[model samples]
Structure formats: C-alpha cells, structure tokens
Target: MVEAVFQILRAGKSLELIMSSYELLNEIEKRFPRIYVSESSGNGSPELVVIEEAWLPFMVSLDVMSSEKETNRRKLRGLFDPNGFHELITGLAEMAYKTNSQRLDTKVCVFIPLSLTLQPASKTTLLQFLGNMLLFQYLVNVLEGDFLARISMYKESMNWNFLRECLINMLLASKRVNYRVLMKECLHTICGLYQDYAGIRNEPDSSDEHSSENHNTDVAIALLEVQRTTCMAMQKLIIMIMEIDMSKQQANMLGLTTRSDGLRIPLIEIILDELTYYRKILPRFLQIFNDPKWKLEIIVQYLLKYTAKPVRTRRSNGPSEDSTFLGVLKSFSDSSSAYMSLTSQQQLPGMPGCNEAVIDSLSLVEISKNVAAAFNSLREADKKIQISSLGKEALFTATMIISTS
Candidate 1:
C-alpha cells in the first residue's frame, strides 16, 4: 500500500492516490471486536472495544502528504496550537519510555514507527498534525547550518523551546521516519562545522581543509558559538531520558516515571554517538549547561553509562565507511577501564536523603569517574590520533582530585 502511494507521490501526480488511501482507512468497520484484561482482584476481566482497525499506514502517509502541500508559509502557521506538535515532540521520548514499560530491560527504545492514524483528530487538528511533522524535517536541517538568526521572521517563530522540542523528537525517531535521512545529513554538517572549529581554534598542523573550509573566521566562530549551546541543551534533553530512568522514585513530581526500568540500548547508542562524535566542541560548549541552574550531574552520568562500552559501528554500504566521528566514538567507548578506577566520591553537603540522594550520589561518582578518564584519555590519546582534543581543560579541578587520589 505504501509502495503504491510512494510511487504516485514520486511521479509528481496529484495526491489522488494518497487521499483515496486516507479515506479508505478512515471508513469505520461495522464488526465490533472484543478484547479482555484480567482484573487483579480475581473478578472477571473487562472487555474493551475499539472503533477502528487503526491502520498505521494512514498515519505514516501524513509525512509525505504534508511535504506535498506545505509549499506556503501560511499553510503551516496553524500548527502552533496550545496542545499540539510542540508537546508531541518534547513528550515523545517520555511517551515511548512508558509505552514499552515492560520491555525497557531489553534495551528496546519506546520510540517506534509512529502510527498517527489512531489519533482522535478533528479535521482542524489533522491538517495541523500533517504540516507540523513535515516542518520538523526542515527545522532539523536548518540547525545544521548558520540559518538561526539570519532571518528576522525565523527569529520570531523559532526559540530555544521550539528547537529543543523538534530536535528531541527527531533524535528519538530518526531511525523510523523521514527524520532519519535529514538528521544523518545534519550530523554530517555539524561534523564539518566541528572540523572547521578545530582547525581554526588550534595552531598550525591542523589540516588546511579544516581552517580553509570556513574562510570567514568570524562566521565560523559565530556558527560554533550557537551550535555549541544548541548541542549542549540538546544533550541535556537526551540525558534527561536516562535521568528519568534513574529518578523513578520521584514519578509523581516529574510525572515522567510511569515506566522507568531504564533507557533502551538503541536510544543510548544514538545519544552516545552524537556526544562522542562532537566531543571536539561539546566540552567547551558544555560550560553553558554547567551553570548550577541545570542538572549537570545527570549529563555526566549519561556519558558514563552509554560511552562506557566501545562504539561498534557495523560495516554497512554507504556513508559508514569513512565517518570521521566513528573512530572517536570507538576510542572513547574503549576507555571504560580508565573510568572505573575512581575509588572515592565527594559528598555534597546538605543533600536530601531519599531516591534523589541515591541518584545524585551515583551521579557524583559517575561525574567524578568520567572526569578522571578524560584526563587519562587525553594524556594517552594525544599520542594516538583518534581521541578528541576538546575538553581536557574543561575538567581541570575534577581531574585534580583523581590525580591526587
């Protein structure tokens, strides 16, 4: 069914085929099916009824549908509803987390191929949903370059929250949707920007291709400055999923712990790959997030847990053959031993006792261990060409404690 629709859309014909598919799925089935669940009290299980078959292809078609019609700026303006696309993106990771509550132990990410056809959308909301998800494709690509503040209208429409919401969803769903292709492109772009930053920021012997790529020093600086902050905040957002797992004790306050067994391995891999690959710029950029206002401990803990194991990229056909960041990720992942040797962790004064304390204490130790490992990785990785050279000085005081120990 999808193949036929894709062919029609690909041919640049009218959206007749796609619309017919939507209407067919939209039709209600007459037969009522029953489902049952056993009650814990030993009473008879309750039977549940669903109105529609919830054809998933209908939902997947929305992406292509919107892309076909979203040529005008005004067409997408109506998507900014109070309880709509914004929340969908920001809350998707958490939702995926809960939906697979029983399966997190297996390292299965709750994020799945979204089936939007099941949503109870009014005609108004349906259009909004289509336009919004399509817009996500452009926004993710935009962040890869210096397009943020270039246009006055873009400045008015997009803010930190907006970007954060979309990117978070994109990261989780990149393996499933149109987001995958574009995000891979965005990663490539960000990697190049990091390369330019590296060559220009360092003294001679840094490759000419790097510094020469962005001949305008001021533009390169501007791009990295914004890119760093965005990436740090994005990292914090990704780390929060793991933090949500660790904070299962406070499910009521955060309203995010319905299923907190743990983060899935795939999600962890995605986060680790980005964080590891961008270690070139992240350590310096991370200072913005280190302000006491944010939860730096969780960020540190996330790094330790995911990067603890070496990144093993399976050989594949296309771009995987020579990605610059893949080598760095593998190197960082292999340094787990250097990270595990920290013997003691400093206790924070006046800390509360409870689940919060457990998470924080674990966080402190993880933070301590990662800091120590980086310094060690640096001293050694300098001799080896693969380790990132960005963050050695970022953890000066923390590394000192390990050295003295």
Candidate 2:
C-alpha cells in the first residue's frame, strides 16, 4: 500500500492527483489497516489487534508525502509550502498514535529531504537545515511538558526553512500570504538555536566540529536573520520586554533585555557576546545598517544597557569581564560613517520612524540622576564626600541646555 502511494505521488503533477492519492490511502486503511478481528473466549467477538510495525515509518511517510507535492519537496521560487509540512507532521503524529508507538521512527526520519526547494545553495537554507535538526531534537526529547509551552518557540527552528521558503513564495505569490506570524515563528527558532549552541559552550576555550569563524559568521548569520526577522515582526516581542511591567517569566524569553528580578540575567550576557561578534563583523553590520530602518535604537538600547549593569569580571586571574561597556560604546562612537549614512538614508521603508523619540524617552538620562542618588546614599554612610567625576561636566552642560530650552 505504501509503495503504491509513493508511485502515485511521483506520477502525479496536479492538485487533483494529490487529492486522489490521499483518498486512496484513506480507503486502503479502512479496509485492511494490516489488522484482523479474532473471536475469543469472552465478550462476543474479541478484537485482536494485529499491529503491523514493520516498515511503519516508510508507510506513514508515504501516506503523507504522496498526498501533497509541496509537502515533501521544495518549490521553485525558494519558498516552502507550509501546508505540505503540516500534512507530513500531522500524518506522522496520527500514524504514531494509531500504531501505539511511543516515538516517531527512523523511517519517518529518512523521508526528510536533503535539500528543500527554496533558494538552492543559499546560506539561508543552510541555517534553516541546522535549525530544523536541533529543533526536532528539542521537541521530540527535551522540555516535553509545561516547560515546553514556555519554549513553544523551540519548534520554530524547524520551520525557519519553511518560513524562508514562504517568504520567497509570497514575493512571487499571485495572492500574498501575510508572513508576519511566519517571520515571528522563524525568529523564535533562531533564538532557540542561539540558546542551544550558546548553552553547549560554557567557556571560550571549548573546541568543536566547526571553526569559530564558521559558527559565528556562517551559523550566526542564519540566527541573525531570525533576529532581523524579529525586528521585522514590528518589534512586538522587543517592546514587550522593554516594558517595565514585564513579568519574570516574560523577561527570560526576551533574551536581550535586562532582568532585575534574577540573581543574574542571561540575556545581557547573550547580548554582550552577540555585540562582541558584531564588532568582529563591523563591516557587515555597517552594510545591514545601510539597508534601511534597521532600528538603530534597539542596537543603541542594547549598547546603553551595559553602561548601567556592567558585567563584573570574575577574578581568578581568570576570565575578565573586560569592561565590555567601553567596547560597545566605542563601536557606536566609531561608526560615525554608518551613523551619518543612517541619518541621511530615506529611513528605509519597512521600519517606522520616531524611534529617536523612543530612545530619548529611555533611562539613558536617568544614569546621571542615579549618580546624584548614589552620592546622597553614600555621603552620610562614610561621613565624607566621595568625589568622583568624569562625564559630570558634560552632564552639567546638557542640563543647562535642557533647563534653558
């Protein structure tokens, strides 16, 4: 039956053929199902379940893939048909339940294509492939409970390929499919990949199958797209994290924001590391900045964050925190050309303006105010005036201008 399904799928080219194949499979399963009813000692006719587990994976895959051309193969325009994927996964899950198997089998795994149809040989596809494998591992194994929903986005790593394909498809689509939700799904996947890979390496000294350049430049680029996509998703998640009222659980998911509730914030460390990478690929980032309204404010927000809660280097004559605040600040200050380009560019289409207003509205000004508060808190404790000044003169000048205005 499975072989028949596969043969028919390969032969068919149109929507009708695909529909027919699925109908055939449904009919076959109803009649045979590779089982039998046997009479027993009790209760009328005892139903003896003869479960045919052999080549189960192949059969299940055939049942799904045969019904939909887009399900198993990549489309021409470099986007994926997500409905195809939906059918495939749904078929696998249904088959697993019917067969009473605890987990999906390798045969089901074997049908997963080597290359998806979208954007042949592009770097985007490479990352999507990696995202899919890692996401599958997490979904089928780790975080299989309530914690799973917390990381519901973990499933997205697999779908990045699909979303990329979908994006391409929409561009050529006769009628476009809104990909905002799809983009968000892909970004979630990318974040998950970053969390996984970043989690695996605890120290800078660790070695792996891929070179650091490959991981950072190649793999990281893919994840970065996910980050970029999130920005495209209208910064919905980003805005949520920035909200002062954000709950502890929500803060954890928005990995780049500062978390006051935790003993330590993981997101800040992640941003620091990401910024370090950005510094390495400064030229590339400069290029992205040139593309459009890349939301320089989000980048600026991240840069300014370290100024407030600078990472304290763990001493051991060991790993030094290295005052990354200065590093980030310097990067921003150094990018005079990029900033000028940004200021002059026509505010690239997708991103809305007024981000400048948002940045001005943030706590950047409060840093100096905090200094006064800190000074007052310490003045009485020590019974001595602790005098330290650096940016104070600049702040004073700025205050004067503000007061006059």
Candidate 3:
C-alpha cells in the first residue's frame, strides 16, 4: 500500500485522489488493515493477509491522493493551493498541541521539513507567533533537550553550514524579540567557542596542524565577523530605541508620562559597560572603533548626549539626586586630566580634538552650575538630588587615574 502511494505521489496524481487518501487514513485506526495473510498452502483455505500500514498515514500526511501524477500536479499547480505547505505546518502544530507534546516526532518532523517554509511577514499574527516560537528561550529549551544531541550529529556529519545558519537564525530571532539577556548569553557562547578554538590551536604537540590552524584562524575569523555584525546591529537597534526614549522624555518634561523600559538602562550605559567588560583588552574595541564603517563619530555624539545633566525625578528627596549628573561630570573631568596635562605640542589621531569636544560637548564649569541650579530648583520631589550635592566636592580633587600601559 505504501509502495502504491509512493508511486502515485511520484507520478503526480489528481487532487481528488489525494483528498480521498487523506480521508481514508483519518478513518483508519492505529493498526493497519492487512490485504492477505497466507498460511501453510496444503490444507488451509487462503487467508487474507494484513500488514501495518505506515505509508498510508505518511502519504496522507503528505496530502497526496491520486494515482494519476499529472492530474495531481495540475491540481497542486499554484503556490496558493489549498493544501499548501502552510496547512501542513498548521496541521502539525495542531497535532502536537493536542497530543501535549513539544517535540515533533522524528517522522512527523521529517515529513514537514522546516526548510520548506517561509519566514512570516511583518505586522502579521503569524509573524508574531513564529517570532515567539523561535525566540532564544525557545531555542535554549531545544538545546537543553534531545535536540542538542541531534544537532551534534549534524555538526559531526560536517554540516557546519547548516549549524551556522541555525545559529544565525537564533541570533536574528533574539534581536527581533528584544531578548537582551538571551542575546548576551548567545554572544558569550560564540566568544567562548572562539576562545576554545584558539586554545586548541595554541596547544603543544598537536599533530593535526591543518585542522588546528583552520579552526583557530578561519573559524575564529568567521565567528568574530558575525559577532561584530551582531554587535553593530544591536547598537543601531538601541540607538533607534534611544531616540524613542528621548522623545518620551521630552514629552514627560512637558508633563506627560512615557512608559518605556528604555529608561531602565540607557544605551550609553550599556556600551560603557560593554567597553569596561573588555577594558584590559582595550586594543580590540579600539580597533573596532577605528574601523572605517562603524561611524565612531556618530556614536561619540550619542555618548556626549548621555553626558547631559541628569534630571532630578520629582520624587527625589535629597541633594544626592540633584548632583547625579555633576558626579558623572566630575568623573569625566578627572579622566580628562591626562589630556589637560599633555601639552599642545603633543600630536595624536583624535587626541587633540578630544579636549575641544569635551569642552564644547559639556564644560566642567557648566556642569557645576547645573548642579547648583538643580539644588536651588529642588522641591520636595527632588530631595534625593539635593542630598547628592556633596558629590560636588569631588571636583576640587580631580586627577587622572592613568595606567602606564
């Protein structure tokens, strides 16, 4: 029966045949109906034999019905055919949900290959559903389950491209969903993988020279390229989100409430944290900053914006809150002492301009004035800022904490 169904499917039979096959399978129980069962030939009457029919359901699942291949092909001519690939996904999802199963059975998953589907389009329910389904958390769940072992088989079989593509998909999904924590974890994993590859290359007495070199150089380069691109993508996303956050603040300044999580962690603060994370390897990030395509100047503009006076919340109760931005300014001034100490005779790329940028961007004197003004302006709502005013004393003792390196 399975052979017959396969023959029909290969032959490209009619739609009616396919529908009938599907309906018939739906009516059948788990056990297959045997056609003929024969025993010893001499004495017993001919017995009907029945075999378990895997193909009936499988073919039906494929939605192939007819023996006439041409008719079926004609019936399924268009991409929008009623029994299109999407319906298969819909059916699979439904079955999986009904069965209380998260893992698609191997046979069922094979029947509906993920590669055959299209990514859902923007602003659509399907897109949202697909995005949620393929989020980093979801992939992490898959990784922690049986899928990890199966994924290893693909890698072991030298299917690195597919694995890489899958990883890329996971990264993109993370960005689309704004799953920051998960995205960071994935980035860390990629970095760890690169470091491990490098360590293997640096190992002593390794015989597989070509493999070690390839792993350390080629694989590491590819990984770094992806990581850089992903980081830039995240930066751009954050910038756009920051713009929205800025607009909200402007509105709020005019007495409107803006509900945004962007305020929870400013983009500049995040970048600063990222930079600090690898401060010991400053050369790497500095190299990245020097890259021609990164638009470091534009990034510098945003960083300057973050240096603006920190506005005191209406709920603040002390001087400390009022001087928050001043404290930051003090820190900046302290750092800039290295620049101040250097003579005009010193020449370096971007260094000469740094002093002017800092002065024009947000002068130390102006920041100090803002701190004083903030305190005078403070009402009961800004008591925190008032309390933080003692931070102003740090300015008088400013000095650079320079490293000889």
Candidate 4:
C-alpha cells in the first residue's frame, strides 16, 4: 500500500492524486516510524529500537541493488537505491544547470523516458520534471525523519551505532555512489533551482501557446511550489549530512568507531574543495548553506587557506597559529615587509617560481577587499543570516583594513 501511494505520487498523473498520495505517505511515516525509542524498565533510560523489518524508502545494500528480483521490485515500486538517487540528483542538476544557462525551452520538449504516457511531448516533459521534484522532496522527507529519530536516540544513548546505520549515512557510504560528485551535484541543484524559481516568481509570464492550457498552468503552479520546497530540501540534506559528519567525528574521538565502519571524507572538506575549484558558485553556496556555525567555519577556513603561512611539519594536525579569522584580518594591517615575510614562503599551486608574484597579486589589500566582498555577498544572499560576535569583529576588522588599504 505504501509502495502504491509512492508510485501514484511519482506518476504525477493528477495534481489531486499527487497531493493526496504525498500527504498519505507522510502521514503513514508519522504514525508508524521505522526508528524510535522505548522506555527501559531497569534504569529509566530510553532504549533505541530500530524496526529492522520495517519498510524503508531506500535500498542501501549491494546485494539488494544487485538482485534481479529486488531490482524488478524496485522498478515496480519506485524505490530509490543509491544509484537511482544519484541519477535523480544528476538529472535535477542537469535540468537546473540548463535553466541557469537560459537554455531550457518549455516549447521544445526534452523527454525523459518514464512509464507515464502522457500526451503532448511538452506536457509530458513538464509532468516528468514535476514528478522528479516530488520524488526528491519525498526522499528528503524520509531521510529527515529517519535522521532526526536516530540523532535523538544518539543524544540520549551516546551510541554511535544508531547514527552509523542511518539511511543518509548508509546511502552516502555505498560504494555505488560518488560521494563528492553527489554533493557537488546537490550543491549545483540547490543554487540553480534557487535562482531559477526566484526568477520565475519575480518575472511576468510571457504568453505562449502552452499558457492557454489550464492543465499546464496548474502543473506550472504546482511545479513552482514543489521546486521551491525541493531547493529547501536539498539544502536540508546537505546540512544534515554535515551534521552526521560532525557526529561521526565526535564518535571517532570517543573511540566508538571501528575499521569495519569504513572511512568517508568529511562533507565540509568536499564542499570547500568544490567551492575552491568553482569559485563562481561560492557565493551561492555560502548563501544557501546558511547554518551559522558551519557557515562561519567554512568562511574562516576558506580565508585561512590563502592567508596563513604553510606548516613545516606533517606531524602537526591543528590549524596554524595565525589561522584564526581575526588573525588573518589583522595580518592585512601589518607592514608590507612583515606581511611579505609571513606569506612569501608559501607557493600557489602550479606556480613554483612565482611566490613573490603570487603574494604581490594576492596582497593584503586585495585579500581584505575580497573578504569584505564575501561578507557582502553573504548578507546579500541571506538578509537574516546571524553574524556571531566573532563574525562581526572579523567583518569590522576586514572593512577597517580595507578602508586603510
């Protein structure tokens, strides 16, 4: 019955049916959670109880993904395995990228092969897009529910096992998924959809042949709402994964993790790597990934990577002594001779002999200017993003140095 409703929602044949099925699935999840806590009789503590046999929206294991019968069942039931989820996110990312490039044409139907045989290629394309959006939203909803339950249990029990077995963790841990690519695609999808939907809402509709169809209009209206929610869901998923990484690190520090658990690179590192390579998306990503703690950390780390002096020893695991945001900003106010001595030894990648040129180009003034620009971008991205006292001090210091420079 759950699978049937999921299929109906994925089919997206009727908006009414889509809403009803979507709501029904959510209600079902709420009433019958797969993970919860039961009060213990002995110590008055809450015991985590995972219903192993309970139905899940994901198929994370390799055996289940490999089996012919299981594969056929997934196809029939619209279940999302890791590979399928990756494909879904990839598709959304591509669609969003195209839209961002202003190459998405509603008049020309780009058909995605699906079971639904809706008439008119354009309508079919729209419906397929809507279906994918709805599907992603539902999956995020499931992940959120499961994660919240597990994290709650972990808080009470301090048991890393419960979180390690979470659906989001398992989904990302699967060998079939490229964790970095998945995160990059997710970042792209969030930024693209955010811009695309905002433009759609702000711009006036240009009348076209398709605009006359009330059915198409209705789908467009629904699509707008779903896409907005989908953008939020993408952000939520990224933030949740970051939360999981933090929790995992905590567990590792406590010696609760094992080798069998395998190693996954922290999501923050991946995000930082992506932003460094694709600086064009940095502002958008910072704007969207608006968790105050992580956001400040990312910004500080990003600045430190360029400004801080290189470490001489591989044994040192901590950040450089001068890596703090305030220190980096203060470095901008130092004498040119002192600043040059501080950063002249560091070499930019692919430019071994140009350390002086690199330092000259990326001068303290230039760094301070960019720092102020980044803060402005953050404020522009989110008017309500809370700047911590440290953040305010850093910003003030950057702007003051910039003015002096």
lDDT of 4 by residue, 318-391 (tens): 63335455445444444442345334534233211112243345667666675676566555545676877866
**TM-score, per-candidate, Cα-based:** 0.29, 0.22, 0.25, 0.74
Candidate 2: list runs displaced more than 4 Å: 1-169, 172-178, 203-405
- By TM-score, who's the top model here? 4
The deviation in Å at residue 83 for candidate 1 is: 22
Against the hidden true structure, what lDDT does model 1 obtain?
0.33
Question: Considering TM-score, where higher is better, how would the candidates rank from best to worst?
Answer: 4, 1, 3, 2
lDDT of 2 by residue, 301-336 (tens): 343333322234456465222223223343233334
- Indicate the residue-level lDDT of 10 in model 2: 36
Model 2 scores a C-alpha lDDT of: 0.33
Output the lDDT of residue 212, model 1. Answer: 51
Mind giving the per-residue lDDT tens digits that candidate 1 earns over 245-305?
Answer: 2333333344432332222343333433565565663553353335442334334433344
CA-lDDT, candidates in order = 0.33, 0.33, 0.33, 0.71
Candidate 3 structure quality by residue, lDDT tens digits, 1-405: 544443332332343343343334323322343222345377664433334443321211122335677546544532112233223224323322222111121111101123323431112222222222222122122222222332343334433322222322223222123444433333333333233333333444324544443322332223223334433333333333333334434445654443321233433344444544654423333433333323343334323333333346788765442123334334234323212322122221211012333445665556555444433343222334334343445333221111111
In order of listing, the candidates' clash counts read: 0, 7, 33, 0
TM-score of 2: 0.22
Worst 10 residues of 3 by lDDT: 101-110
